[model samples]
Target: MPEPEDSATLYAELLDSARRLSFDLRDCQTGTDDADRYGMTPEWSPLYGTPTWIRMSEPERRRLTRREVTHFLGVAIWLEIALQIVLLRRNHSADPTRPDVKFLFNECADENLHSLMFVGAIEQLGERHSPLDRVMILMGWVFRTFAWEEVAYGIVLAGEEVFDVMQRDWSIDDRVAPAVRRSSHVHVVEESRHMSFARQKMRDRLRGVSRVRRYVSAVLIAFGAHIIAKGLINKGVYRGLGLDWQVARTEIGRNEHHRMMFRRATAPLVEFLDREGLLNGLARSIYRKSNLL
Candidate 1:
């Protein structure tokens, strides 16, 4: 692919975005004594509107929400670790004088802080790991080592964009816990810049790339997105709430409301990827199975 047109200008814009959007992690504090409350709206809950949800007592639902939110935060940490590794690998040899390199380093710093925040949130809510966590970590290692530049960045972009949608929602809803809302607000504000950078990077890397690579990237990105979406709500969450794990998972999968939420959250990303020729037939099928199409 050809070099970024006027890299200096692109660098300047990214640097300015980083500067203007940075947030201090220390500012994410809750004044309420019951700060460990549920982190999102009941409507945003995974099993919301399901028959199981209707049958669940209020306390059961609230406990599930808290645990599910913690699992989601754990997912954030998982994604951030992969993202930081790929980003650092991508730009490690970049010219320090370039604005893009500086911006990338800044992003790594932001992600580091974000990871710490997520860990704190998870600890506060009680950490719960998915059964797939170990496998996902191995996948992250493979991705950082072998995935094509555009594909790696595309994967990163997919996670950030999808999570940004949820965080944007959580940040504004008054029903969410204050500390959780603050974290979501910070993430939405900072990830907007990361998303911009990742999109442009994907565009640059895709320029003049071979068709086979594009097709492979499309499938891989979709597959990665599938894992992410499924792993967001762990079975442990249901077990913790005294529900049958398989039944809860099945109900969540079949829940039209929950499926619609995924579709809506991923719509912008789907549009952008399709416009860029990264959402091919195979990718669309994969997204459909994940309820993101």
Candidate 2:
């Protein structure tokens, strides 16, 4: 209830939330059925599927494809590792006075597992390209160095901006299985709370920093998030469905909705940065071009 700082309380909440969310999600966490739960046959894979199945690909996918919904689970794995590295290296050991910050660490473990399950779905794709390569590129230059607030905000925004809508409708996707749907349900419910907590933390913690620090971190965060999105959301799906992945991403970018959601998703961080006086001229130009405002 109190305004959060980079202190013990934040750690406490992070621990509490992580525990509840992790416990609740245990049912869907089992990876045994993940590969089979969907209609994932080689026939279902655009790679080897019947012409009829390939031809009948959904418009949303044809229009804005991503890897199997399950793969998102896997990508979540690297993200967790990346964040944990940051937390462990940067954690204020004495800050354990706050229950929330503890929650962040605890939740990080669960989130890591959740993301691994998602990534497992991706590995199932058997791409000519390595998802690990994509993961390394995104994590190194993008997510590695950031003000924790930006990382916190980015996670919530990803959930609230994109996946919030995605989780609900994916149940009907021929690509997703019932078990995965059950898992995603956990993500949807728990992440909704996580989003609120992350956003709240952003609002509370990101203030009062030097304007320069705020601006730098925001730009960095957005840049990093964009790279991951392209790799995961853009390239990952097209290839999974056996399409010309590169061409499809280019084509889908022309779609108004995806572009809009992207901008909207990253907007809060941008605005937060702007208020902190971090928007350099180049960053401003980029943000304007992003058309997220």
Candidate 3:
């Protein structure tokens, strides 16, 4: 458990971090257009290096990549919405006078802004409808009702960290669309603070947590991570492009480059979970299935 003073100091540092990273979205040029039609680096695509990718026409590849990026941001928006609800519920009864409580409010506001930015990107990229969007909405409502503090926070941490790795790449890669790259850069800057806060909260939640509880929490966390991993790109994307969604999903699974990227991206979080004894037993197996181990 963190000392009161320690927690307070952490919150102060987080507030400083947030202030330093903050930006006004109105000033950002969010207009995405035909010029922003480039695909991600081959390595970032699930079908990269596969026979399928080699056979794809340049236009088809570009369309898929653009749709995939749109889907990615769409899922991110959903995840942030769910996270905001979970965080709000966690802090529902918090002492408003505390610095930590104020920080929670600030974090919620940050997530709201992020949601807008993500929505803006999707709007600019032409919306791709997916059945998974409805599922995500239902899941968000269901998950919000339960204040599974440790489990919920762990999912948030895992999701953010995984995307942070991908976004870091896009933020610097000139080949990526300018709007996509700029949005990523903005998110990377702001989310660094949110990620720091989540890590601290996860650690605090795990401190002295019982083995039985840890076991249940670990499974739940892995399950959540798996859903998030699979949810990033929905079948609707492939279907919209006149391709077989099932085949695309299968090829993505067989794409070692994609699998390795997931494993590498999640390495830090997995190591942390293991050190905290939250990555043992069933949790480890589940992560392996998700290619996150």
Provide the overall lDDT of each model, using Cα atoms, as 2-decimal numbers. Answer: 0.79, 0.51, 0.77
- Give the runs in model 2 whose Cα sits over 4 Å from its true position: 1-66, 116-142, 145-161, 171-176, 233-242, 260-293
| Model 3 agreement with the true structure over 1-293: per-residue lDDT tens digits | 22367767898888988877687564555555554455445467777777778889877777778778877787787778888888787778877767777788888898888878776766666556455656666666766777487787788788888888888888788767766777888888888888777777777777787879988988888888888887875878888888887888888988888889999889988987888778877898899988888
Minimal lDDT window, size 10, model 3:
33-42
lDDT of 1 by residue, 1-293 (tens): 23566655775787887887688775455233244456676777889989898988776776777777877887788788887777677677777766777778888889889988776666555536445566576777788788777777787777787788888888888767666777898899888888888888788878888999889999999988887887776776778767898998889878999989889889989999999999999999999998889
What is the TM-score (0 to 1) of candidate 3? 0.92
lDDT comparing candidate 3 with the true structure = 0.77
Per-residue CA lDDT of model 2 for 51-80, tens digit only, reads 323455454332222244444544555565
Native-to-model Cα distance after best TM-score fit, residue 16 in candidate 3, in Å = 1.5
List RMSD in Å for every model shown. 2.2, 6.3, 2.0
Question: Which residue segments of model 1 deviate by more than 4 Å?
Answer: 27-36, 126-132
- Between the candidate structures 1 and 2, which one is better when assessed by TM-score? 1
When sorted by lDDT, best at the front, the candidate numbers are: 1, 3, 2
Stronger candidate by lDDT (2 vs 3) = 3
